[model samples]
Target chain A: MSYLKEKILKDGVVLDGNVLKVDSFLNHQIDPVVLKEISNEFIEYFKDKEITKVMTIEASGIAPAILVASHLNIPMLFAKKTEPSTLSNEDQFSTNVHSYTKNKTSRVLVSKQYLTPDDKVLIIDDFLANGEAALGLIDLVEQAKAEVVGVGICVEKSFQPGRAKIEDKGVDIFSICRIASLENNKITFVEDEH
Target chain B: MSYLKEKILKDGVVLDGNVLKVDSFLNHQIDPVVLKEISNEFIEYFKDKEITKVMTIEASGIAPAILVASHLNIPMLFAKKTEPSTLSNEDQFSTNVHSYTKNKTSRVLVSKQYLTPDDKVLIIDDFLANGEAALGLIDLVEQAKAEVVGVGICVEKSFQPGRAKIEDKGVDIFSICRIASLENNKITFVEDEH
Candidate 1:
């Protein structure tokens, strides 16, 4: 976790409007070494949960989520940012998510066939901002009558209300790196209180 | 390869319009075991190519591509389907690609910093249909002045012209499972040719 914190400080850019652009080695262009270590850390944190599957939203979250799933030897599912409905998508679970960064509302979808009532899913994502994406994923999983074991985040913007929002649902949440403040174009971290 | 072909026949659904829906394990909901096998097979085939980095498009391609990158201990870069030009996306390598299945066109973008002139890249993707996505990735890589070693695909619809289109560019392409036909509600496959 300290290494991830250091990595964020080193490669993460504190842009205007409080955006930590660590896309260099975290999201867009991924470093496998970092991802491997991140997965192991998450596994150690959530190992005893008896997680049946790992899930995340599309695009950015897939890289780390898949690595964690592979290490746990479980299946990984992603809710698509629902495209132009071209298939038999009638039996899907979907919820609207308002992107905090992008300033848009879009539907996140997962087939009911994938998330069953018996699954204990571990939700993962690249970043936790306003908790919109995580809440949307939890909605989809619960719609299938499945259980969300917990939520694992690569980076959490603690200044935002995302952590509080998810904890209100009574789900255990763990983040590898937590940015206490991105105020005045400076990245500051707070110790993660397990 | 044989296991992959068997998985296609067993779990893959043959939808209307030559659409082979392998969502049970390949994409959407993924089986990490299958992904591990696919990555190993691709690595074995392209081991001598001196691949410096593994690249793919976002969402579906990230799972398999990241696994390959982890096994090879290198970096993985993905071309984004591009949001509404939010950040400093002015300096990017982008090209438009028409989705063969979706019946639409979208621009794929990669940051100029990731794909460098010194890179010997290997492309990994989930499916190859009309070769639009693969070609778009190749276009992005070449725009950054990087060398493309080969293309690795999880499934290829041989009935389509994807393979031929990529081969026309003189790129070595390998697919784990080659479906010779997906007509009349049947999933038929042909032997892989090296």
Candidate 2:
């Protein structure tokens, strides 16, 4: 987590005193080496949970989810933002998520065949700001009758209500990098709280 | 490659005599073990190319591209389908791509910081049918003046014109599993070709 924290301090960009842009190595452009280490960190944090599948949302979270899934030797399922024409119209779980960035609401869905009641799911994502996407993923998992063991995030905005929302759901959330605030073009880390 | 070929034979679903769905292990739901093997196969095929970076589009391609980048010890850049507000509006390369599935054309963009003229990129993607996405990615690479050593695909429909289009640009294309035809729910692979 320290490595991730340091990487955030070094490469992460703070914009409008709130948004943290890690496009250089975390989101848009990925550093697979750092990503491997991040996934290993997640595995270390949740190794005892007996995770059956690692889940994430499409686009940004897929890369880290792949690393976590690969290291854990588990399958990864990403909830699609758009329903692909190829997917059958049978037995699917879905929920609507509002994106503050895109300023729109989109339905995220996963086929029931991928998730089952017998599976223990670990939800992973790139960023947890307002936690809408994470909540949507949790909804999909619940609809499939699977239990969510925990939520693993690469970066969390502590100033936002995302953490409180997920915590209110009584699900344990783990983030590698926790930001206290982004002010005056500077990033502050959430210290003494790992 | 044989493992992937066998996986396609075993789990791939042929639909509408044209669409081949390997969502069970490749796209929607990812098998990390198979993905690791597939990335290794790509590495073996392009080991001599001195790839500096691995590139792909968002959503599906990020998983395989991560494995390839990790195995090769390089960076991975995914062209974003929509430009995130967090990304700086400076020094970016953009291209328009038509998605057959979504039935729309969207602009894909990548920051210029990720790709450079000296970088040799290996483009990776989940499927190559019409090659529109691949061509768009190649355009992004070209805009940055980067060299595309090769394009790696998980599943290629040789029955389609994707291969010929990419080959016309004189870049090498490698596919783990090549489907000759998908007719009547039967998947036919291109034989005696690796």
Candidate 3:
């Protein structure tokens, strides 16, 4: 988490008043070395839990999910934003998510064959702002009758209510980097106990 | 490669004499152990290349690209299918790609900050059918004036024109599993050299 914080301070761009852009390493362009460290950090945090699979959404979350899956030696399932023709029509679970960034509500889906009652899922994502995407993934996991062990997020905006909303549902959450504020164009971190 | 072939025969679903679905291991619900094997196979294929970065498009391709990048201990950059609000407004290298599955065309963009002239990229993907996505990624790499060392595909449909179209661009391509034909719900592989 320290390495990720350092990278963000060095290369992360602060836009507007609330957005923290880390396309240089975290999202668009990925640093596999740093990702590996991030992956280990997630594993370390969830080491006590029984995680059968690591689940995430498409695009930004895939790289980190894959690395953490590789690190923990667990299978990863990403809910696709665009449904491919190869997907089976009969056996599938779907949900609609609103993205403030894209300014559109799109349906995200995963095959019912992937998630099952036997699995213990760990939901992971790159950013936790409004927690809409994470909530959607949690819905899919619940539909499969699988217990979500916990949620691991790379970055969380403490100014937002995503953490409280997810926690209100009784799902434990772990965020590697928590942003306390982005005031005066300066990035601030939340206390570790938060 | 043998492991991949076996996985296809065992779990792959043949559809309409044109599609082979390996969603169980390659996409959708991914098997990390199998992905690791697939990643190792790609490493073997491009053993002699000096790959500075591994690149792919979002959604399905990100999983394999990260695996390969981690295998080589390099960075991985995934092209965004849709520009989120978090991304910069700076000029990006964009290319249009037509998806046969969705029967649509979409723009794939890579932040110029991630790629540069000095980078040597290895493009990887889950399925190479018509080569539209691969070509778009190659275009992005070239737009940055970078060298595309080669392309690595997990599953290639040899009956399609994808292989010919990409090879025509004069870039080396390696596919771990090549399907020669899919007829009557049967899957056959193009003779494996390995």
| Highest-lDDT candidate | 2
* Interface RMSD of candidate number 2: 1.1
Q: Which stretches of candidate 2 lie over 4 Å from their true place?
A: B88-90
Interface RMSD of 3: 1.4
lDDT of 1 by residue, B26-136 (tens): 888899889999999999999999999999998799999999999999999988986523346677888999986677899889889888999999999999989999999
Tell me which residue pairs clash in candidate 2: none
Per-residue lDDT for A1-194 in model 2, tens only?
Answer: 47777788888877883778889999988887679878888999998999999999988899889888988899999999878777766867889999987789998899889999999999999999999999999999998889999999989988899999999999999988888888887888898665
Native A-B contacts reproduced, model 1: 0.86
What lDDT tens digits, residue by residue, belong to model 3 across residues A1-194? 48888898888888885889898788888887779878888889889988889999987888888887877788899998877777766777999899876678999999998899999999999999999999999999998999999999998998998999999999999998899999888998997733
> What TM-score should be assigned to candidate 3?
0.96
Residues forming the 10-long window of minimal summed lDDT in candidate 3 chain A: A82-91
Please give the CA lDDT of all the candidate structures.
0.88, 0.89, 0.87
For B1-194, candidate 3 gives per-residue lDDT tens digits of 47888888888888874777788888887888788888998999899999999999987888888888887888889888887676555768899999887779998898887899999999999989899999999999999999999999989988889989989999999988888889777787887542
Interface DockQ per candidate: 0.76, 0.86, 0.80
Q: Which residue ranges in model 3 land beyond 4 Å of their true spot?
A: A88-90, B88-90, B192-194
What is residue B99's positional error in candidate 1, in angstroms? Answer: 0.9
lDDT at position B115, candidate 1 = 85
**Per-candidate iRMSD:** 1.6, 1.1, 1.4
Instruction: Return the candidate ranking by TM-score, descending.
Output: 2, 1, 3
TM-scores, in order shown?
0.97, 0.97, 0.96
